[model samples]
Target: MGSKHVFVVAVIYSLCAVAVASNPCVSTCAGRPTGDYQSRNGCNVYATCVNGYICDNRPCVAGTVWDDTLKRCEMTSTTCPPNPCVTSCNGLVSGDYQSCNGCNVYVTCNAGHLIDNRPCPSTLVWDDSLRACARTSSTCS
Candidate 1:
């Protein structure tokens, strides 16, 4: 019985120590705002600035404009362009934009449309319904 109690106590202590060591920062600390100096509590807690204002060195300041669409802050009197999908129409077929590549811009076929010139077996015909070149009939080849 004594050994069992000692083992249980050791297990509880180990669990508590692991929990404490995993998360060392408190939830009430604030992060420093961009273009502002770092505050003492900036690195401690996870607080943020209120709407229409930004946290500067753990303090809130006015005149900090926020781009609600972008979910980021910007300087005053800054103008952002409209949505890319609306303006550029690149990669848009009918009304949809393609997924982004690493650095190259390209268009993606929307529903019911297929990419042209893909390799297909001579016996099979390109089927837009299947999104791949498939045999028109099983007897084709």
Candidate 2:
């Protein structure tokens, strides 16, 4: 009977692990703003963080996946992978812009608040000199 109980516990743990792996909405919003963020687990899943609390997992439509660079759902690409945005709006004034993670993704500040993670158009990247997306492959520092 004890062996059976142990087996059951192990099975339960394995099942939980599988669930978490397949769900793909794994993010802790402790210090993050209230908004939707692309999940690193999968391309089609996103997480909703509200006031530093996790809200729920949102899935993109059929044939679509969450674009971390654009902070929106777009058609899946051949090289789709989880590229999460790690920018913060803290200490930034309104109209300030910067990119984190990569030059293809960026964030803006609004009245001391953080905005969504925006992405440059395809084949384009963020250019701080022009303060806009431009056609280039240069890495952002």
RMSD of 1: 22.2
Q: List candidate 1 stretches off by more than 4 Å.
A: 1-116, 137-141
User: How would you encode candidate 1's per-residue C-alpha lDDT over 1-141 as one tens digit per residue?
Assistant: 697666444432332222233322122224423233212121211224443344433422443432323334444312221111122322223312211221122223434353323335565543321223455521111
Clashing pairs in 1: 29-45, 29-46
* lDDT for 69 (candidate 1): 32
The lDDT for every candidate, in the order shown, is: 0.29, 0.53
Off by over 4 Å in 2: 1-26, 77-141
- TM-score of each candidate structure, all chains considered together: 0.18, 0.37
- lDDT per residue for candidate 2 within 1-141, as digits (tens), equals 697666444432332233334332335788877877655334555677887888544877865766555667787532233222225544333443446657776666666577656887878877543446788532243
Best by lDDT: 2
